[model samples]
Target: IRAHHADLAKLLTSVKGVGPTTASTLLAQLPELGKLNRKQITALVGLAPMNRDSGTLRGQRHIFGGRADVRRVLFVAALVGTRFNPVLKAFYARLLAAGEPKKVALVACMHKLLVILNAIARSKSPWSNEIATVV
Candidate 1:
């Protein structure tokens, strides 16, 4: 994979917690990785939150309807990222500190991870702490 798609492989694997399988899944399953904007990419991956409001009753926001296979891979990556990736770790901590549920915080991290990856891919650059933080 590296020999054939060296640039992409490097870019995808630059982030912590993103291993061979995650990179491979992104490259193979999400061909539109770099081609789309942040919102577009997240929606495509089903990480974008969907509204669930009805009349005066406000329902809990939920994410649904996108690439399940990609979402599954991202879920694992995000879980690992919360522990290993500095940006994600900090973000997750902040969310939890703000009283967000574990599951909610993790899903937010997943969305963030995907956005960071999307930005890196779009910029055609390898991951960097500074860049990740900025994104």
Candidate 2:
């Protein structure tokens, strides 16, 4: 797998929390990873919030309908990222400080992590903390 999608897999696993299994799952299951924009990619991975509302009534946005396998692996990676990755750790802390629930904060980290991976893949660049800071 890495032999074929070497750069993509390498770039993803370069992140603090992503492992070979997660990277492989992404490469195999999420072919649209680098091809889409942030919102598009997150939505594809089932990380983007879906609105549950009727006309003139804004309800809580929930995540649904995408690659469940990918989302499942991402959830595990995001949990590790919140502790090991400096940028993600800070982001997770900020979300908690703002009164976000633990699950919500973790999902948001998953979203951010996927976005950063997508950006790196699209640009054909290795992961960098400097670039991650911008996300």
Q: Ten residues in a row with the worst lDDT in model 1?
A: 1-10
Q: Which sections of candidate 1 miss by over 4 Å?
A: 1-4
Per-residue lDDT tens digits for candidate 1, residues 1-135, read 557466887888889989889988898899899889889999998889999998998998899999999899889999999999999999999999999999999999999999899888888888898778887
lDDT of 2: 0.90
Cα lDDT tens digits, model 2, 17-72, are 99999999999999987799999999887889999899999999999899999999
Question: For model 2, which pairs clash?
Answer: none
Error of 2 at 28 (Å): 0.4
Query: Candidate 1, residue 106: CA error in Å?
Result: 0.5
